[model samples]
Target: MNLSEFMNTEIVAGNTLWRITGLFGLLLVGFTAGKLLKFILSRRAEQLREPRPIIAATLGAIGRAAPFLAFALGLAAGTSLLVLNGASELVGTCVAIVVTLAISWTAICLVDAPKAWMTQRAGQTESKLDDMLAPIVSKSLIATIVVLTVVQIAQILSGKEITSILAGLGIGGLAFALAAQDTIKNLFGSMVLLADRPFEVGDRIVVDSTDGTVETVGMRSTRVRTLTGHLVTIPNGELANKSIENVTKRPHIRRIFNITITYDTPPAKVAEAKAILEEIMKDHEGMDPEFPPRVFFNEFQNSALNLFCIYWYHPALWWDYLALTERINMQILERFNEAGIDFAFPTQTVHLAGDPSRPLEVGVKGS
Candidate 1:
């Protein structure tokens, strides 16, 4: 139509062509603003070390958001030119509702961008736990966003703040709290385990009476592989309060024990035994040389003489320590046999101290 004819046409009842032109003008301005915003954000995206997929999409969404909002506002205002007296208020409320939803979704997506980037990078890491967490964290973020979005939608539709809804929860909130107590407590306990890092997967740990290697840490519990090959699951809530002995974190494994020699063993032989242990420890590469091996005549017992022995080994892997200990014990036994030194064994001597007429009474005393 010619410009004059278009200006004379009615878009809606009592809405002339000039008002329609104004709406289009507002839309054109909004479109221009959106394009400018996109150009600005594109420059920022180029500076990233590794530009993620969400960077472009998020920037695009944000760019289009302004124009979409402006267009909605202009359309709602244009409704006033219609014959309907309440059209403007109704359309404006609808526009506000739509904008609220769009804003909420955009905010959620922007927050999720970094997490998406992290998920992509997590696979490249050597840690299996981190690899597993990628999907778990992603899903968790999705669930959280969904819940928050539901709340946002509710507030927008109901036109009531969340605090007012909460205040009216009354008994329902109390019931929910009671039901979720254990879950929340366990959740916090898991957080503590993650933060404190008492032990990692594949590390041997002793908690309470249970001893095993940590297999995996889950949200509610930690799985363990025992030495006997049994799988044990301990709840994080219980684990957090337990005393954890992380064997892998130690600098050295200290070996302490008592070895007894028969009373027939001469004092010179006892000294020789100490020298033998010292020489054995010195030759072993795994043994800690900084801390000298010690063998001392601890005490004179009824059956044998006790020698207290102390030694330590570096980079304390349990298997390494056990293997070396076996070798040392065998060598000690062979040397003792060659030198005619006997290991202590339990023995007893019985004495009868009573009247001759009475039957023999056994009073047990032993050495």
Candidate 2:
């Protein structure tokens, strides 16, 4: 047989040899072009990253999805020139699915570029709102893309109209919503938290029995790293309704204490105790001028004299304040001891019935 005759020979699917060869040729050309484009874009993206990060990221994402996208397009084009006999619908459906997946893959990759850019920008700023918002936005968009892709694939498989499929989905969604009411509420609660701006990441907060730093806030839950090193995940719905004390927001830490002295101390000694406290506490470390330390001999108890002391420490750093408190306590101890001042303890005096200090008379009564 001559060349033309051999080329005209029909294949099993009614596709002639020449046509099959052309189909493969187109596919090979498409793949080669796609590979070349991917290489060029990848190199360009790498070179441009430092100067134009956003554009570079976009190019990189496109390059990563180029091969699959080109292959799917090539398959569609090559199949169009073939006679599939009884498999035309099957081939077309498969091509549609491939196209949908390829597009979805590209879109999903594209989402990463913007998300990374947003995250980087957020890092540069002081506000944490964007830091928490960036990931949520990316996930939401990716989810939307996946949902649409699934709907398209379903329509292709079931040969249904988009409107009818959506209607059915709406009914099913209502049932799903009813079953997952808590999840929906948590999502809305997340929205409320974002709007309220109550606390940011790394803020120390007290909610009911949980005292911790906010690690992350998500659509369903907020993660807290507790003081005891345990991670607690609280649903946003419940957190929204609960009372939260943001300890990080306080301007100062106030301390109230009592200095007790023995009642046997003379009036001069009592006055001297108050003066010593005033001298020790004056211009204390971390002290706020507006909320100065106070020393007052406020009360006389049954066995002791009570000196009420109060002070406010600024900047509110727990460890620093504790250090200052320790130093002040040591100073008080040293000063009081040097002045021959004694700290009071609980004590009692009793007199016996036949003691020299006290004599008691008892009358016996006959019943």
Candidate 3:
């Protein structure tokens, strides 16, 4: 309102209030342009058949900072409207730094976006190994980038070597490294499992006296659904070292048993029994024909003639094989009965030719 105050304050053609209002107008334009840019970029991203997150992310980052860069430019232009002689140069430098930093942040986003997207996608796979690896890779990438960023920031601020920054963190870093020892070892173990592929998810395996189908393989441990209906978690560190037997991986299962007949069974009848058994093995759908089943008179036991039989079941599933076995056994019994072949029982004959009257002075051990 006073003459001296008004005269000194008016650096541009307009009063201070008018200049301030123009500054705001320019900022408003910057804000509107940034929003328009963001919308167009995001809409175009949505049109892509498969979104490559890196592309979308880089554009998104630039769109977000466009307004800030415009605002800084406007502010730089407005610097002459003030009374400070040094303000223009300082504002220009600041604006340049801000633009550079914004672009740098966008680059970082470009690198980081794909990893995050990949981690998310890996979780959708049927294999449990992928699920375990995704998070570990994601977190490791994040941690490494963060540490490097901090060290760079330090080097920029203090003009020190990267080595100096590392030195300062030594004690704390040592403690953290010590604590993560087991975790690191387990991660390596999981990596070994992935590479070796001893067993996969849903495989029935026996390891360390535990029998089950593998439920999940994780970075730290593997979960198994045991035959007894319990879940057992074994650390990957131990699992990698154990001998794992993948039972389901075998081609076929073997069955060996004996069929008994009375000692008095005629040799001709015995030969017929063996022939019938071989036929049964051949007639079954699941029996492995290449390995031809065998039935032979092995030996005469305490009270019976023993027939040794060997056979195989293909497509080796436990329940399926067992049911097939039951059917084969019943069929054998039926066929033998029809042929008048007698199964064995314990029998003994006693000699009493000269002991009929002397039997009063003698006794049978098991009479």
- Leading candidate by TM-score: 2
Native-to-model Cα distance after best TM-score fit, residue 134 in candidate 1, in Å: 5.3
The lDDT, on a scale of 0 to 1, for candidate 1 is 0.72
Evaluate residue 214 in candidate 1 and report its C-alpha lDDT on the 0 to 100 scale.
87
lDDT tens per residue, model 3, 1-367: 7865654465454446556656677767766776787788777666642556556655665666566666665665665455445555555555555544544454444554655566556656765555555555655665566666666656655567888888877877889879988877887888898889888777899997899988877778889999999999998888899899988688999999999999778889999999998888875767666877888898989889999998888888889989999999899989999999998878885657567654644657884
**What are the clash counts of all predictions, listed in order?**
0, 0, 0
Question: Which lDDT tens digits does candidate 2 get at residues 1-367?
Answer: 9999999899866899988988898788878887887899899999988888888889988988888888888888999989987899999999999999999999998997888799779978999888778877887889899999999999999999999999999999999999999999999999999999788888999999999999998888999999999999999999999888999999999999999999889999999999999888899878878988999999988778999999889999999999989988999999999999999977776667877667887679889
Model 1, span 228-298: residue lDDT tens: 88999998888998899998789998899888888878889988876776676664757665876787788
2 against 3, candidate with superior lDDT: 2
Backbone clashes in model 2, listed as residue pairs: none
- RMSD for each of the candidates: 9.7, 3.4, 8.3
Q: Which parts of model 2 have CA positions greater than 4 angstroms off? A: 1-11, 16-53, 301-303, 351-367
Q: TM-score for each prediction? A: 0.58, 0.85, 0.58
> What's the lDDT of the predicted structure labeled candidate 3?
0.74
* Weakest ten-residue segment in model 1 by summed lDDT: 127-136
lDDT for predicted candidate 2 compared with the true structure: 0.90
Give candidate 3's TM-score. 0.58
Residue 20, model 1: Cα distance from true site in angstroms: 32
